[model samples]
Target chain A: MTNFPDIASIRKDFPILNEVIGGKQLVYFDNAATTQKPRIVLDALSGYYEHYNANIHRGIHHLAEKATGAFEDTRRRMQKFINAPLSEEVIFTYGTTDSINLVAQSYGRKFLKEGDEIIISTMEHHSNIVPWQMLCEEKGCVLRVIPINDEGELLMDEYEKMLSGKTKIVSVVHASNALGTINPVSDIIKKAHKVGAKVLLDGAQASSHLFLDVQALDVDFYALSLHKIYGPTGMGILYGKKELLDAMPPYRGGGEMIKEVTFEKTTYNELPYKFEAGTPNIADVVAAKYALDYVDTLGKDNIAKYESELLKYATDAVREIPGLKIIGQAKDKVSVLSFVIEGMHHQDIAVILDNQGIAVRTGHHCTQPLMSRLGILGTTRASFAVYNTIEEIDSLIKGLHKAKKMLG
Target chain B: MTIKEAQDELIEDFELFDDWESKYEYIIDLGKQFPPLEEQFKTEENIIKGCQSRVWLNAYMDGELLKFEADSDAIIVRGLVSMLVKVLSGHTPEEIASADLYFMERIGLHQHLAQTRSNGLASMLKQMRTYGIAYQAAE
Candidate 1:
């Protein structure tokens, strides 16, 4: 038996894991949707709202000073977490969707012209797709999609072929949320750069599983949510090359984002504040730094190594269950297992699993087009995080077996 | 009307009707009770965009309350619209704005709805509320 991290010790950090659901300990398999935060991260939230609840960067009061320092500390922490070239490169938004929308509106609207092609893969989330579609509608640009094969891997040759002189941008996911395919983003960036196109990565699913160095990849823009990585909701990071960020237009018109404002004219603020317009989610942003700290303590490599083993174990075990078909069986994958039973509806399976205190995400997963591409209505997706254990995977398999017998 | 009368009216109209099939029949039946909206009102402006079923919502004010008549092509979605109309229509603009819609839980309507279906309903309500807001502002 391989030596694994102590499941009991790890489970202790999350209070909700101890609660009985339907008279059983909760087996949380819905990490991709959102993660259960550690006590430290949770405490950081209450600590912020309770102790230093004030608007950041504006007031000269003591609470405001404290709030400003802690809020900026998160930006610095994110800069280090992603190995971003500078702290100014990090901009905060509501979440991944909001971050992507900022890029689409600011960069895509400004740079893209009529007949310019914006290329994206078929595996992108609706967050990545809809924003660009909105831009294309506004700017009269054509949206080009790179097709995926049966295994859910991007056809790299097809991707390269799709790029041309007219290709203005290439935006793709760093890791597919549904398929768990860890895309070769570096290669994609290099290929796009050769064609004089900027590349943006939807890093929502990759931030926890992979170590991101925005400078190394030379990725033009990267967007991800902190909630999906064990932080609070309503906080996300958008990292851009400083020059690119400096050149882009402001996303929203609000209080914090202006240098000087009058009825006659308005001058926009600097790189990050230009993008972050409103009074930001200060409490959540402060808590988000602790999420990065938690990941840092684990070491990304160790987390990936353990998760890869868990994935293999899950795949092998699930393959044995009769009439169960795992969706998206790519060789390179994160710890996501999407599957469908021969006769059972994904929703029915989810309800049955819930009865057994196993939580999993069911339905189109906000990737309705991908579901259409796969010829399935939806899937039951079980995604793993660093805190998830093989024991949890065992519980999931057993629950499925019981659910099949009961619902089948 | 008393809260109980309103609650009973909603329950009788929505829940006892059962499946979206029966519920939609009730909605189409409700459309018969309201005065006719002009054929010209069927323009794209009155259309609710994200609905899987084609829906047309038209409204007018009667004294202090706003009254609406909505129609849809699909059965279940039509029934959903009927349920919304029952709770939302014939209420003051402020009342419509302030309604918590905890009624969805009572009807067990949203519990059975898919995410898309839920979102569509929410979107339709948002549109209706926006109209109410505009009407109130104009007043």
Candidate 2:
């Protein structure tokens, strides 16, 4: 038995947990969509706006320098968090979707050619799938998908066969938002390197639960959203190899991204600033460091251990419910428990659960192709975080029983 | 009954439930009791796509009265559609286009109308009104 963090105190860190909805205590089971921010993170956000509100990187005044220092400090923290070789490799963006779009437009469009194949998995969120599709449409590149088995595990052997000289890049989710399957991204990256293909891992879900070491994995690009990791919304990071980032064109032409802008000829900024276009989400980016620090203090391994136990407890209890089938039963998974009732619509279940103040995500989960692959419309996903407890899982189980009875 | 009268009746019916649980239970029962749209009417053209649930709505003018038949894969959505049909169906196109739908708010199900929920109820309301406007134009 692993020693878990004090969940009672951890839950206390997030004020939203105290909220009452529909006359019931809020039980948040939708961590996969976005985790609730800790007080430290929230305080950091308000602190930035109140204490040091200024446009970063350009102003010479005291407030500007302070804001710039804080914003850039986040980059350094994220670099350490992900074990990137250089802080300059961490480019801030809107979110995971924006990060992927940057690579698709700048790297894929610039390098990929006709007949060049881009490989992705069937279980990818729409963010991962759509950007590459958009790139392929423009560049005349072929898009290939690695199929999954009945249990939502990637067909690695099939993926191996799919890789070849034509494979330009392989993009896949490190941990699936819909399924919670912790993908074998290390093996994936190694195989892609063999075929001379770059690899980009969507770390939106994994950053919260898994230890991210980009240098060890030799991953070329890593993208994630801060909101999913207990940080503010509208903030994300795109960590690309310095060499590749240096070679790629700028994603957007704006003030920070440009070194010199004359109508005749324009020169771009160095490293991350080249990709970070305009004034970034400075306040959210500043607050993101506190979120990461919170995770660091609690320890990722501890969080993972506790969440896994939560997943096991939830899985065992949920299996007893009649007509309820769990989806994506991968041997290696995070704390996501996705299931579908035999005769009940997921939305109907969501509505019932909502009234009980149990927030679960019920839908295709932005992974339509994955749902189609499983031969199901959607699943009701109850994802756990470090702050979540077994009692909350019990609440979810009770809510589900209520849903089953009422719907049945 | 006029649209206003039908809405008042729905509000009155919902007022009987003391708690949200019973109110939702009533809505779920209404959903289950609500008839499914005929197979022919569940075509792609009739489908109103919501992010969470799929709704099929078929509207046509029955003489001078506008008639609407709808179904949703989600029971709660179907219940909402059932309410819409009960209140707006069999009314003149002009009447439906101008009808105020205050019962949802009064019944404490206004959260369903939120765009974030995207249960298709909001879109269904809009589509019904669009149909009403279209039929009225033809007249």
CAPRI band for model 2: high
Best by DockQ: 2
Worst 10 residues of 2 chain B by lDDT: B111-120
Q: Judged by lDDT against the true structure, how good is candidate 2?
A: 0.93
Best by lDDT: 2
User: Runs in model 1 with CA error above 4 Å?
Assistant: A1-4, B1-139
lDDT of each: 0.82, 0.93
In model 2, the Cα lDDT at residue B114 comes to 76
**Candidate 2 — which residues are off by over 4 angstroms?**
A1-3
Model 1: lDDT of residue A23? 72
Q: Mind giving the per-residue lDDT tens digits that candidate 2 earns over A162-249?
A: 9999999999999999999999999999999999999999999999999999999999999999999999999899999999999999
lDDT of 1 by residue, A109-221 (tens): 88889999999989989999999999999999999999999899999999999999999999999999998999999999999999999999999999889888988999999
Question: Against the true two-chain complex, what DockQ does each candidate achieve?
Answer: 0.05, 0.88
| lDDT by residue for model 2 (B42-107), tens | 999998888899999999888899999999999988888899899999999999999988988888
| CAPRI classification of candidate 1 | incorrect
TM-score of 1: 0.77
